[model samples]
Target: MRPAMLIRLALLALLVAFIVTPETFAPVFQPFTKNGAPAIYTQTSLLSLTLSHLAIVAVATVAATLFSVGLAIIVTRPFGVEFLPLSRSIANIGQTFPPVAVLALAVPMFGFGPIPTLIALFLYGLLPIFENALTGLTNLPGNVSEAARGVGMTGRQRLTQVEFPLALPVILAGVRLSVVISLATATIGSTVAAKTLGEVIIAGLLSNNTAFVLQGGLVVGVLALLIHDAFVMFERSIARRTGRLY
Candidate 1:
């Protein structure tokens, strides 16, 4: 196996160990404790919180990917070319406001829980995926696009069989960014009573438990790194098969 892959595996193993036996890792945080008690984040299951965190990010990222890619595809087509600016502006709408603000606004309508967080994450993740999709769809070499047309492929056929496949790596690059960002950002959902690793971090902050904060941050950071590396590997594999790189 590659060195990077080995490192990722090691990290995954360590994360699992920490989550499964958080008490074993308590000594590491003991020095950072404010109270005389042992520093361990035992109030909730670390594994469960981590799973909830992943679930929220996964849902939001998938939703963002679908919307962004669809809009990108629409705007790239001849009939939809006129709407490019409007689509872009719409995509940018999410980024123009902070996600916290979005959450604050959504809470009134969605009530406290994952719904508001979901909306905030979905919107926060849109711009990267949309921009990458736009770039991928628009940057195809002229001859490559012409060759698809020359083959008498229908618009749909050309798109599905040629353009989309060729553009997928670039689109996945955006997805990588979106997923990583969402994983880290989703922690904020805990502020509104949504279950996330942020709950640990917030508890730490509120009670001066540095251990809780560190544990939460460490888990989120490792998860992000692992997912980012996974996407990089995937993109590289696709690139190799497509002759995008030797």
Candidate 2:
């Protein structure tokens, strides 16, 4: 079988095992338990935080997309090559910063709750967004760009009409990456008392209750997969409907 096919099969097996494993449905998988009346409200209470985390991710996606695309455009010119070094440096720097440390630092300024989590996720989300946007813009077909220029298309017109549309696939691929990372990291935000499904996992950890952790983790993992699939569907639909694909 082809390597890609094999890999896909393996991934499917892994996903199935994770979902079907006995550990997933255990009422309580460990030596701990929530107090009586803890009920399912624990999970419900966390919904607000989870939504807040997603909100931050949305904000981050929008803000980072604009900055990244703009930065890509700026750095593409010969006169603007100087910005390339700076852009690379900043992108690298952002990735190197420990996300938890960024969250901790934000706490003093933002003061508890979800704000710090948002800022950390925002910073963490930028590198991929910027890098992908930069790559997509740079790798655009030269003939297409030249054709536009030959027709007397202004720089802005060429960018909007030719470059940007063709670059969308690559750019969206980066966005898909950011979305997955943001979902995973939102769980970490629970450590900072930020609202999210992470609350389930953390609560389970603190009290040594595996069931809660599994439940929260299972929900989160499924949600991440669903979101990833949604993006794939969206990207494919765009490609087909736009005639980017045959």
Candidate 3:
């Protein structure tokens, strides 16, 4: 609705158009190639690569969200309170290790392709979601919680109806961070034979073709920016609906 958001949407549209029909702008990339060695990557369709890349990120992020949010909820419960440290440790393992390392470690068991990449991304995206969920679940206003208890609400009822609704915006903030991180990191999935935009960049790097690299990087960077902005808008809407924002 705002001018800035409209501008970003327009730019994203142009980038998506470029990815879909790169040959239309071959002349622009001509300078980046040598001896007319194809200014665009043609080994695989960039649109297909982009779609596959998104699919991988979507799947991984969903898995990470479920696991991390579940674990956070558990640790916030009375019976599971003592295991908070252990849960944090488990979530930290994902952030502590590099995605590449996770891929290398997973490849031996999962073999090449999207499986390893999914494992890497799923692990890499856990910490932010877990941390945010934990913070949201634990930091409720005391009086609001008391009101929930006073209303003949059981612990489960309070959690499902009162606590979680209040905590959703914060939890979604964590998910936004994880999704953006996973978007960038998912590029590395190409190294393990996964179909992604990284294939374009990797091909460029291998053949010393900057044009290919630029195409891949531009798409991924713009996609990340657009997704980040969308998440911000969604979070603000949620905050307003929850009366966290005036």
Q: Considering summed lDDT, which 10 consecutive residues are worst modelled in model 1?
A: 237-246
Where does candidate 2 stray beyond 4 Å? Answer: 1-46, 241-246
Clash pairs detected, candidate 3: none
**Candidate 1 residue spans exceeding 4 A from truth:** none
Q: In terms of TM-score, which candidate is stronger, 2 or 3?
A: 3
Could you give candidate 3's per-residue lDDT for residues 66-114 as a string of tens digits?
9999999999999999999999999998889899999999999989999
Q: Estimate each model's TM-score.
A: 0.97, 0.80, 0.97
How far residue 186's Cα lies from its native spot in candidate 1, in Å, is 0.4
Model 3 per-residue lDDT at 89: 93
Q: Write candidate 1's Cα lDDT for 156-199 as tens digits.
A: 99889888888888999999999999998899999998899999
Residues 37-155, model 2: lDDT tens digits:
23232444444545665676777677767777778778976668788988877766548887788887888888878777777777777788778788878887788889999999998
Can you give the lDDT of residue 90 in candidate 2? 71
Q: What is the clash count for each candidate, in the order shown?
A: 0, 1, 0
